[model samples]
Target: MPLPAMPIETDLLLAHLNGQRQHVLGILDGLDEDALRRPVLPSGWSCLGLVRHLTEDVERFWFRCVMGGEPTAIVALSQGTEAWQVDPDVPAAVVLDRYRQEIDRANAVLAGTPLDAPPAWWPPDQLGDWRLASAREVILHVITETACHAGHLDAVRELIDGRTWLVITT
Candidate 1:
């Protein structure tokens, strides 16, 4: 179990980050196999695909990209496009569980690290500038990105089953 919460900005940011993550995953709560696989748009990204994408995204961005250093292994290998592609063999349940697990791992990283630590790896452009990103910067970026994806998940969930879970409910 998580220790007692800190009454500070880090806690607030993490709360919002985890909330957005949970919000996106919650969209698939009652969905069946076929329903989860149903495409929200003609482009062919199903609801399951979005969850899987977020799984990789959160893990890759927060844990790997920020915590491990910039341009982590996933980025070196796939350059961020891999998350958008869904594996046909993997089941939706596994994808959902993975997202949940990723979130837990991310929270642990956030909890153990300080917000003021500078990134281990800085982009070439930010090397000498005043824009070096601290752990706090990465955390905020993840929160914002997750929230944006949650909006996408909202539209996809509605298109799939007409349930507007992002705004009206969990």
Candidate 2:
């Protein structure tokens, strides 16, 4: 069956955000289980662990918990789970799949929301005076954070096997 065309009136901020998300995933491509789970840097964060962090802290935290006011995400946040520490028993595929699923849910929240809309919930206790007043701010924040982590992944992937996300020839 033929696929439907994407809607013409797409959100510009969302486009950038999704691009960064894809960039993160792209940097993780072609890595084996050991490579994905190996901590190349001194910080001790694996690629899969970074993906898990993005899934929980960035996507689910911003869109589901703060913007959409999802109770499960709220409770999860309250418990302060360490999103960047993946257990040995957890497969790399599981972490990647969870990130993809969280992206889908985050997109759902973004679809019904206006850029100017205030977040439905905020962690006043945890954040203290810090705040993101609108959906636009949140999206921009996520995009920035995702892009930063994508660069981190690019460096890590290169250290793993000399892979680069992009190359320029002059």
Candidate 3:
């Protein structure tokens, strides 16, 4: 999706997020399994690690945290190491697939619920802070998170092989 140069909502936010997704997708495309899993930075964070983390983060916000209470006990703890070892034995491709699944689920939940519908999950105190958000706000948070991680992945790509960011879609 083509993104706008301005900071407007709706189209701008959606377009920007689509752009970020494209950017990350580009970084992942045409890479071997090793390349995808390789640590491209000094801290050993790989493209796969960032993808997994972003997926989980957004899932928490949009699905469990934003909509309801924590559904599972599997919490993400970043050690900033090679491949991020979420479940050390899992492969990069597996993590990426999990991310894709979570994103779809989160999107569906967000699309089905109204923005003003009271969140089913947060604590009473947290409720006050979140009570007023529209669905737009929730989506904006997702976009912001995705864009931030896309930038991180871009830097990792550059570090790995001096790759530059180019538009993925016109």
Candidate 4:
């Protein structure tokens, strides 16, 4: 079958991404400290860790590093993978707030950019210049990344409480 005409790709992308975003948040809803902190993987990442990591990395990598042409990528923790490690002392609620704020900042960056244009360029914290990507590609990448993580959280939530965010209706 031929693809349906899409007048604006960005709007379609944002809609689908936001839908997945909601599910990620939904899985975290009503969870107490134990549920949020319980490790679902042998690697020891909890639900809270996934949320916190996404909160910081989304904006820094996509907006600042790629779109704004900044070299040094700012993250929740400068220590790379440790960014996904959660500190149990902090409330899961706080991490969600930070995620929302970063998303607002990211949205502003998207609003001001022309999707097809060459992304801004700077130099080095980790990324090579060869990895430069366009605004459109970055948006799609963010959506894909968010959706992928949401799937992880879905499994984590189910393992923690035997509950799921998905439903099937015929």
Candidate 5:
């Protein structure tokens, strides 16, 4: 299915968001399963765990639950599962696939909805007084969050194998 057309600003935002998402994935490329699952920093978050967090918390929570008011997403958010923990039995491929799936779903929400549209649902109890009035605001917030995490992933990847996202060449 094709995504619906979006305004230019929305398109730009989505483009930036997608870039960061790819940056995150690119940082983890070529890592073995053990390296992906192994925590390299004091924060105790592995590359795979960060991908899971982006899938469940950032992509699913903001796009599905907040923008689309998806019932399953609402239930999942209400349960308050920690998104940063990947079960030992879960394969690395599964974690990566889920992130891709969530990105597709999130894009669907962004495509069909107008930037000015208010969120379909908001969890007052979950967020307390905080609020985002429109889809544009939500997109901006997600872009910032995803980009920040991509930077973190870059650092983690560096720690793992001295790989960096970018290298300045003269």
Candidate 6:
């Protein structure tokens, strides 16, 4: 896909960053609770779990880390000691909507901010007199974080069913 454009073309970095989100969207789109909550491999991570993790991650890293100047102390709720604590009572629909919306919000922030804009969360040195990153770096950060999750989601998706993202033509 050519990528969806806003009023401005933020450049290749943003496009690449958005691509990772698109990858995640592909993993999420058609899943229901049965498919989303199914376990994969050695860990207990599920499609829904992955979405939750990504949603929090996107907010912490993109919205907080970059835009709001906050920290990323929030860990994945499904990881390590907390793995077994996920509330089974939670509905998949709510989780999915929240995840999708957070991702869209992150995209909106990236689109609205200039690539060279200084994120409130950046280190003081980086945000110094001539601070602010090249638009490419911010997008690159988003891409790297999101792509790793996308990879994990892809595997989780495959484990849930037999689907591979590459297998679908559309």
How many clashing pairs per prediction, in order?
0, 0, 1, 0, 0, 2
Candidates arranged by TM-score, highest first? 5, 2, 4, 1, 3, 6
Candidate 3's residue-wise lDDT over 1-170, tens digit each? 33224324544555666677677777777666677778776767667777777766565555655565444623553334422544558776788778777766665565455555555554346335645355566666777778787878777777767776865776
lDDT of 3: 0.63
Using lDDT as the yardstick, the better of models 2 and 4 is 2
Which ten residues in a row are the worst by lDDT in model 4? 1-10
Supply the TM-score for candidate 6: 0.69
For model 6, the stretches where C-alpha displacement exceeds 4 angstroms are 1-11, 70-86, 122-135, 168-170
lDDT score for residue 48 of model 5: 93
- What's the TM for model 4? 0.84
lDDT of 6 by residue, 1-170 (tens): 34355544565666776677789878766887777777765666667766676677555555645675545544443335352324689898887777667766676666666656666665445335854365456567667878998898887777767677877456
lDDT at position 21, candidate 2 = 93
Model 1 misplacement above 4 A: 1-7, 70-81, 122-132, 166-170
Deviation in angstroms for 158 in model 6?
A: 2.3
lDDT of each: 0.71, 0.85, 0.63, 0.74, 0.87, 0.65
TM-score of each: 0.79, 0.89, 0.69, 0.84, 0.93, 0.69
Q: Which stretches of candidate 2 lie over 4 Å from their true place?
A: 1-10, 74-81
The candidate, 2 or 3, that scores higher on TM-score is 2
Clashes of 1: 0
lDDT of 4 at 118: 71
- Residue 111, model 5, lDDT: 88
Best by lDDT: 5
Query: Which of 2 and 6 is ahead in TM-score?
Result: 2
Candidate 1 residue pairs in clash (backbone atoms < 3 Å)? none
Question: What's the CA error at residue 11 for candidate 4, in Å?
Answer: 1.4
Q: Name the lDDT value of residue 163 in candidate 3.
A: 78
On residues 114-165, what C-alpha lDDT tens digit does candidate 5 reach at each position?
9999999887687778999999999999999999999998888888889999
